[model samples]
Target: MAAKDLSTMYGLSESDPEQKLINRAGMSASDLEQIDRIMAEMGRMRQIERRIMRSSQEFMKLNETDMRALRKIISAKHAGRSVTPGELSQYLGISSASVTKMIDRLEAHGHVLRTKHPTDRRSQCVEVTEETHLAARDQVGRHHAKRFEAASRLSSEERDVVIKFLAGTSDAMESSLGSPLDDDAR
Candidate 1:
């Protein structure tokens, strides 16, 4: 499609609200190209991300719900906070009862611990056990090492550029979308 046609599809005509907004912001063709490049890079990155996630899930032998819960627990723990089942439910947008069930399974498997909440007598906080911590660290390290080994086949500068671009792209995306996994909602 022509650039004009493509832009129109996105509601970017001269008379459209989007064009007026772009004009007020003084966006140029290069800026638009940068946005386009970033979006294209995002698409490629998503494909790679999905493959990596699938491979990691397979390596960990985790199903969808288990993986989701584990990720929430690990991420929260990594941020130095014990997450309540209710908080996890809110974060995952699931029912609290479902989170409770998942937490039970995780606790039973020794991956997580449920303890009385410090401030709430009726609530419990979920904490990752040492086993979960060690397992995550080891698995991530192996996956990263493998990815690095593959990248090493590229010229040093190319590898560095790719890594830098991906990091920057990730940061930009996180800033734009508020979360890395937000796109997964679609």
Candidate 2:
């Protein structure tokens, strides 16, 4: 089989000057080339993330929001806490009614259960079913564990630098939205 062309998948190579922004004052071609390579890696990571999301959604038979809800519930469970519909609504930035509908859908699919609140008799708690939890752990959870391993392999200084770079990138994206993201939204 012919070798696949990565340039087409990853956009123009660093050697293509037209693909890069105007070079900053005092920056050499070498600097620009490095920046282009970094941006290309970022694009590759984004594409991989999209593929992973599609595969996870398909395998789990759930939409993005459903998967996010499940993740929140799993987090809460790990923290030794129970989640309520109201909490889910707040976390998801959706209306209570919408959260109720989502819960209904999840419950019907046997992914979650509505259990009586251990502390509050007036409210109920949401729990991930054992089967669903195990499945998620076996799939997405395992993937994330690999990510943790990769991050752990980085030196503390390297991790700090990565953290700062990612934060700056996130801030730039939020700024491009024409308004700052709210603290709660973050």
Candidate 3:
């Protein structure tokens, strides 16, 4: 389709300063409404995830920040990556000193362990203990696994488009807000 036709499909027009480029280019109101509905569903999913996380937090007897830190560790391990205090600090967008205190708290609670970095003598990596790891998996893994299963139901072409769209939206939001992951830290 021509760019003009494409623009008209999305409800863009000259009067919308916020969407000037899109306007200049014609978005149909119906397309805009559809986008809004998709975004609303995404928000609903986020709410459900938060509820699941809250349940896990209560079970672990930890506050939001602590749970978030643990999640970062879990996510890193899942990705075959070792997370350092410094990296955690970056993830949390906090000072290294604050990260140390959080790490200390987790260690004191037997949820985490500190060890020498395999290749870096001067640095250390944090790991979640096996018991804690299992607990975390039990807490939130089901929802994640279900989501994975849902993804498996998609055709490759559909998955590729969805992956690209998700990445594009995330990147666009980060670009607009000048923050990576938005309020994901907490």
The lDDT of model 1 is 0.71
Candidate 2: tens digits of C-alpha lDDT, residues 45-91 = 77887888789889989998898899999989999999999998888
TM-scores for candidates 1 onward, in order: 0.54, 0.83, 0.71
Weakest ten-residue segment in model 1 by summed lDDT: 1-10
Per-candidate Cα lDDT values, in order, are 0.71, 0.83, 0.79
Residue-by-residue lDDT tens digits, candidate 3, 1-186: 222222232332323548645542365667766665565567667778889989999988788878878888888889998989998898778899998998899999999999899899999999999988999889878788999998999999999999998888878877998865634532
RMSD of each: 8.3, 4.2, 6.9
Q: Candidate 1 lDDT, tens digit per residue, 48-134?
A: 778877776786676676776776777777787777888788777789889888888878878888888889899889888887777
Please give the ranking of all candidate structures by lDDT, highest first, separated by commas. Answer: 2, 3, 1
Candidate number of the best lDDT: 2
Which candidate do you rate higher for TM-score, 1 or 3? 3
The TM-score between candidate 2 and the true structure equals 0.83
C-alpha lDDT (0 to 100) for residue 51 of candidate 1: 85
How well does candidate 3 score on lDDT at residue 164? 93
